[model samples]
Target: MANPVLLNNIDHKDLHVQTGRGAMFGDNVMSALTFPSEFRDIQACYPIVFRKADDGNFEAHALFGFQEGENLFLGMHGWEAPYVPLTIERQPFLIGTNGTELMVHVDLENPRISSSDGERVFLPHGGTTEYLERVNSTLLAIHQGLQQSRGFMAALLEYHLLESFAFDIELDDGSQYRLAGFYTINEERLSALAGAVLERLNRAGYLQPIYMVIAAMSNFRTLIERKNRVHAAQC
Candidate 1:
């Protein structure tokens, strides 16, 4: 546990705490563009391992709940599945994150093929589209669930509930692709997004305790976005 470092409350810049112990939850987590080498190789387990580690998949819906909880407790719930290993099984790929956004880099022996799970794998501008299509469908399900969920009061509340998720797909041969998981609730930047949500929910007279948090996250998201965008532009 990296010495179980005591990260203070102030240390929480955006309250993005991952729950899994070894691979999923670690201090080594960095921007999607980069990952530690140890995580980049998996001669045995492939897509299944990578899928579970990625917090953006439908299999990972509870990840947001895990994040909200980890905002308070360092230990978020570890995602588990039958084929999934308790330990993060490397799958010839790397998964990186920020807030609700995600990125995945796949390292394949073959230069021209794209694949997921145990499929035969295909090439760029090909079956990769299927994976992307599925991600879109999954997100639609999430949004539909959000729309139909019980507690929503207004568009503001609904928008605030939306989380940003992006994917960067890379192959071993340096071939790459990307897909947007969810459109930000509004084209507006983070501050505008949070403020609109909080004001709407507060006026609605619901989730007061949660509103206090929404207020904090409002500023946090803005700051993180500014920092990340600047860093990305630099890179």
Candidate 2:
């Protein structure tokens, strides 16, 4: 459970946030919620896929590992990937709303929260610190990016571009793993669309993200390699 409170420099003046990456800080995960805005960066390091949320809405995710609670990108030194998804970076904090105004809220119980060490939330004079400013930016970006995803998903559904996929992996030791319950953009369906439809999608700023998602599929090989390395080391 989250103990979220509207952040204020007064009550939380001495608070600190540990910015290091590790499972202790809750980095272990198979995937993170992603949005079209970061698809380019996400595609470079992780495979972007879609999954149906409990609410029955499709949500985009940047795949980090094949198994549940397994994040191949995370290591003892830190995250191995060239880019960490913004969703992963924004920890211990989330956006809230006060009527028409957006507000920043901190999860008091999050492991990243500290009092004596790590990045300070407020400066000595009771103003936000650089770390807090970046957090604010990250939160705002997430807020806007999620809003953008609604229309992007609507466009995908309109064009029937999403298709379910299953991946079967065989490790060096002959261990087999099956990744299911994920969706990807159907290239065939996308290619078959009429030019006017394509133009409409492009005009709506959804085309590049579509291509980015397609490009991200290539990173599955990287993911497999990482898994194999982990398996080999375990032997």
Task: Give TM-scores for every candidate, taking all chains together and pairing residue i with residue i.
Answer: 0.21, 0.98
Question: Which residue pairs clash within candidate 2?
Answer: none
Predicted candidate 1 versus true structure: per-residue lDDT over 1-235, tens digit per residue: 0122222223322222122333333312211111111111211111111111254421211111111122111123432222222122333333344566644433333222232333322233233434333433443443443333234323334455444545453433444444344322222433465676667655754434233323322333332333344345446
What lDDT does candidate 1 reach at residue 92? Answer: 32
Writing each residue's lDDT as its tens digit, candidate 2 over 1-235 gives 7899999989999999999998999999999999999999999999999999999999999999998999998887999987989988989899999898999999999999999889999998998898999999999999999999999999999999999999999998999999999999999999999999999999989999999999999999999999999999999
For candidate 2, give the lDDT: 0.95
Q: Which candidate number maximizes TM-score?
A: 2
What are the clashing pairs of model 1? 114-122
